[model samples]
Target chain A: MAMLDVTPQANGTAPQAARKPRSHARMAWTAFMAILRRDIVVTARDFIPFLLQVLVQPLFFLFIFGKVLPNLANSGTSSGFGNTFTVLLLPGIVALTSFTTALQGVTLPLVLDLGFAREIDDRLQSPLPVSLVAVEKVVFAAMRGIIGGTVIFPLAYLILGNSFQVRTDAIPQLIGTLVLVAMAGATVGLTIGTLVKPEQISLLFALILTPLLFTGCTYYNWSGLSSIKWFQIVTLFNPLTYGSEGLRKFMMPPITVTTPAGPQSFTIPTLDAQWIFLGLGVAIVAFFLIGLQTFRRRVVS
Target chain B: MAQLTDNAIEVIDLVKHYPKAPVNAVDGVSFTARRGEIFGLLGPNGAGKTTTIGVLTTSVVPTSGKALIMGHDVTADPIGTKQLIAIVPQQSNLDRSLRARDILTFHAAYHGVPRRERNARADALLAEMGLADRAKEKLTRYSGGMGQRLMIARALMHSPAVLFLDEPTNNLDPQSRLFLWERIQQMNREGLTILLTTHDMLEADQLCQRIAIMDHGKVLALDTPDELKKIIPGGTSLELRVALPQPALVSATGTAREESGLLTALRALPGADKVDEIAADPNDPAQEGITRYRLYGQDAGTLTAPALQAVSANGGELRDLHLARPSLEDVFIYLTGRNLR
Candidate 1:
């Protein structure tokens, strides 16, 4: 033989075998990464269309509502409310786009795999736990969310000109919030994917994702909705509301307004940083548990 | 010759009933395959063969009863059981997202196949399946037969101790069916235990070393094909429907066709076993308004001529006649199921 060949042998051990936990862990990790590799290859194959999908909606929203409409409101003038409006709009738009990417990335394929194609059967048949299979999906979707969130920053700077107010000091906070928000969004997708029936998948996206974007405080800030008291409270229940607010908490400059007592920078307003983290934390835990349960139900039975 | 080891699959008193369903899908079905045996579950539609295979492959949970794959309980240690078995489903469940090459590679990865050896094993299996030339093509480009071949190759990627083929030849052409049959036999010869489900009588008889004939969610008979044939009153089955000149339903003597001694006439002949009258399907336009009877015989080739003469001698007109070989269907009908309506 020209080269040495390693045989294709499987470690046919019992799952309940307590003697070899180390080998079992390695096998589980190997299977998990294999599924991840497959997902990456498949996603990368459609990279262009996916990239365009994530960018197009937010790009247009930033352009039309933040750029064109503000300029028109300011009577076609250059320097006015456009700057403030873009700064306020940028965080929400980015949150909306990235979260929506995570949600759809997990939900659409999950519905198809469970409902029509039955491709998930292969993973269920793999030498790993079914719950781990579901977790891998959320993990991959969250990764996309992080990427989608990061890719928007340069675009925001380009469109908003000098109006972009990303505080350089808050880089760590921004990275942390970005990852957490992505995880929250991906978990929500996992929940929706498992809950929705394949036949009603079209209705599922329209009923869930659309309402999420509209009511998620994506188009407006939660603090700005003072007049609508009930609506503000309701938006607090929405996870994406926290995502937008969290990004704003980290990225935007901390409460600065001109007051009678010199320049005031003391009070952080009603949308507290602590509450945003709490809401996202709850979403990640609650949705993942629910999604994992339903996913096991659908696959095993 | 391959060494026959301990049981590769052991399913006992298995029962699976969907919620609110009138009957159990798999009712008290029990069987075991010794290592390296080419075992089969042969049945008509709704026989619960698929469900039985489903439980074994970890895709379905049993309502009750125990199933062990190589002494590992499927429900308790499913991951352990999964490491031992792989199923080629009845439906096209291959990853449509990947090419043939990626599908094989991904499946190898899923089973924890070594990274370095993944491509080599996949390449060898593809070449064995005669699909190496088209490994880069999209799955949609492959024909039904080629897709099935790829699935079989993928199932073997892990070199599972037991492989499941759920109606592997269901929609395949004759040439492809023969090709797959040969492949299945080759795999079995290499010391890989195989379990397959099918409704085709000829398939079960030809391929399976030991067959379990199932119907109505139960295994009606299980044995080697020859032994199963020997257990029947006669090995060959002769089924024929006769249309009388008058109203056949005039008397419900269970059937008007049985009022004559045509049943006795056929049973009296040499090479003939007891004759049973099966109610003709009311929905079948060709066989409607007539009474059908099945005559089990030692040799259908010898009994066919005399049996046709006997039908005519009893003043009955033979509308249609079918001589089924000593296959799974003969064992199926002999063990008592609804007529092949």
Candidate 2:
């Protein structure tokens, strides 16, 4: 064994074989990162103006819901009547902000580039499979989503000032919720981005997205819609509802209701958090796969 | 891993049929392109030029037959085929949001260029295409010619084995066209195989080492420009411009007779050979209002210079005279009986 293995040439060949596969994997990772970098750079270049617009919108919403609505509702005192408006709307703002940021990640520019500009053609022709490009889009959207969420959360807090009560211990849960919410929006964005022609993008926002946003559970909790069973069931079809509900559960006070099951609940109990995370994870993964496939076909065809 | 070889492109009877069409869009077109040749697929509109290129580039599937790049069948090994080729479509498809150089770098990285090499390659390609000055400008700011140049640079960034240019300068101005053609020629000469398609026959004549002219999904002719020109009905085409009218007047210097200013061909002459025509100009060449005639001879040299000297010496002004060899257009008309347009 010693004589056979002693040769430098034999030892070199053995390592080379092992090294090839590992290096190949590394090379693939590098390609993936290049795609990610390209997206982020483009996103960042436009990030300044986009962030200005994004920050303004959330700030406006914060002013409206956090300051104006509470003041108008509680006679400028906002302290009385439970001052829960801030906490109630915090999660909604989070979802809305993330959703808006995620929407751009896959909207007019993406659609125009796919259908008209054909910029995606370059990416599709890459040695990496088309699915990787699609995934990178989601990753870019997720990064922007997290950034939007992080930016809006503290601002929402600073503006609300004691009106909102976000449980400190549930920070991990909030992070998980934001991640999933961003993913859901990004996937829907990718799917819709591929579906709509560039000329029809305005109609997409006017018709589909506007209606979804209006009916989404952005203003109220799933538990609050007790009387409207059918409406609640219908809302379940929307990923936004789940996003908002999961987010609210992590932010607002735990609302308990007495039902036939006695003390039925919507909150993800500490011990059962994994189930919520799992559900969110599954939804993200499923939408991602569907979006990935749709994007690939759209690019190829 | 599939390996790239000397023949950059090999298509064998490639056919592509759309869903509702009664016939294939591309019907049984075949050709082999060497590794570093500038090959042109010349054809009229709807001649399956785009369809054939789309199939070869993997943008569309062939209904039947096979196209291989670097020895890998496009249908069987799409990713490998794609990795070795880049297609610059007839349309401008630049990423408007990105800076000019980013297009090249992004494309290079997409083809698996490492991060360390991407920037340098992108810069080199842009510089090679004379686009370094505008590298930081977004595509939205670039003009059509700059955009087209950038597209070429992007395609070459990965140093693809073959580059497919589908009408690379279709809508460009004359200056831009000449610029791009020179760059394209340089690229081919630098050892990159180029497969270009264009309806402009002159471009094909000037640039292509070999060209295939197609029409209605059929290969009308395939050869060098000179060879294709020889296929025209007449061995040589002679366009003689006479300032007069439809045809030039012809009379023998010594023995011909003219009645009412009409010169008679007067058959086999002693001093000259068979002169075919004397009529008004088919295409009026000048404002002289003078009538002209055309001549056809098995040997034009037998009578051309002598006839011109004789006409000038005989007090008739030889206002306009031109002789040209047949062009690819002549061959195209001879073969297809129509203009490519």
Candidate 3:
């Protein structure tokens, strides 16, 4: 019984015609592109809901902090900090929105994919290595971050009007920061998705991410914590802090406000771009490796 | 022309002992499924059928030994082997976000089928699976049967050399089961080497050219359905129920088969080769004093009259007498002494 030598195909018409042989690299690349394309098509069909999902929180924050609070603060003793606050807040909002958008982009879909039904099997069946599938998730999520970041600019302008100033120089540095921040956000999202139980997702936000976002230095410059030296060091633990500081380094210009007294400089200090990129690069690599390990355990078993 | 090795799947002493498992899930299982034949792994749940399919599909790594698909080692060359095989797993793993047409097309794309060829094949498979009209429908709207057909269509997208169906019709209605059975036969006829796992004895009997009957992580019997039935001394059996000689008034219900000597007499009959005295279930009071014995022979017809004569000669009253054609179920019971799992 171990040896079956019967020629069952002797007279059987070959079910498949001979396929053209493809190189291993070519097949893997094709499968990767297919998964990416499928994700894009799915996202495009529900683009409005997607936009609502990632944009709602950031937009609400932008309106409340960038417009309402600063205006209210102007009527109070903290008068000078209003417009200067919104100016620095613009770049920080861009950073956090991009980071959180990318994070949610990967984590939400992965909850369904790795749930009991394991819908991920549909793609895992493809002729690609296990790690490549996780890579695809990160790549697609990064694209969403880029889109969220781009869309935030126009929306921020509408909220702050002339207060949203950008000396949009260091074009290459800005681009690099955008890519690095998006990648960091996505890899962290991947890690959470694979490691946490689906039911723990909501709790993860309420506990881990919300507090992290609050301390990420998105509403204020990282250097503004010089008075609270402990928080100055503590905020660095948040990956979103590096992203916010990185975007601020390249995007924010020194604020100049002309008042009844005279023109005054409103200084909002930012961390150096070099240090921010270094921290972000390390986090992305570390989370990517961790995500890959967790993803393989959850999928292949 | 010299014949190349045409076995589509070769599993050699494959074993998978999951970490912390008390026993190996698949213990030294080995079999070669010849090309274009419908081969079956018939076993109950937890009998290692799914694990074996996992090993073959490269989803479950073996703890020891090896499995190959068309000579590509599963562990060493999963990508290459995966290119030649497609699996329809027990659970529905369909991408619920995509339309049925997109599901097929995306599957083709994943297999590296070129863009021009993808749509054509997807449409063709949909039409063949009787899902052409609902090609644009969302998966949420699909019935279980329709979804199963869609899975079948998706698996065929790559025109794979080997197709693995892990309990293919597990939860489908009978109508769907029959439809899928016909589809499997058609695919096998057209020269696709098909390996399916099913606990359905009728399914194995009706569909497979050969079957491996597994129990407790081992293949207990492996042969064609007819050949397996021949494991019992009779391809047919005389299923006889007879009342035994009266015991003492105090011991009336129990010990009587030894007193009657009918078991030995039945075994000594002209055509009968084997006899088993079935112990009446003590838990069931309905079978109180009657003893049942099965007389197995090459031809059960020849044993009926002689068995009745022997019973009468032994002063035992015949209760029921019928010739039973042995089934794979009987063979399983004969081999394992347990039914189902």
Best by lDDT: 3
**By the lDDT metric, which is better: model 2 or model 3?**
3
Of candidate 2 chain B, the 10-residue stretch with the lowest lDDT total is B253-262
Best by the DockQ measure: 1
C-alpha DockQ for predicted model 1 = 0.37
Q: Which tens-of-lDDT digit does each residue in A1-301 have in candidate 1?
A: 1111222332222222222333556777888999998889888999998789889887888788877888786685543455556666788887887798898889988998998899788887888888999999999999999889888999877886756667788789889988988998899999999888889977886888778888888777788899999999889888999999888777766545454666556322337888988999999999999999999888887
CA lDDT, every model vs. true structure = 0.81, 0.70, 0.83
lDDT of 3 by residue, B184-302 (tens): 88788778899999988889999999999988788888899999988998588887888776764647444454444777788788888777776676777887777778777889888
* Local accuracy of candidate 1 as per-residue lDDT tens digits, B221-247: 889998888876656678888875554
Write down the worst ten-residue block by lDDT for model 1 chain B: B251-260
The regions of model 3 sitting more than 4 angstroms off are A1-17, A257-261, B1-3, B238-323
Query: Where does candidate 2 stray beyond 4 Å?
Result: A1-28, A76-82, A254-286, B1-5, B238-324
Predicted candidate 2 versus true structure: per-residue lDDT over B147-171, tens digit per residue: 8988887887666778899998889
In model 3, pairs of residues that clash are none
Q: After superposition, how far is residue B320 of candidate 1 from its true place, in Å?
A: 5.1
Q: Is candidate 1 or candidate 3 better by DockQ?
A: 1
TM-score of each: 0.89, 0.79, 0.87
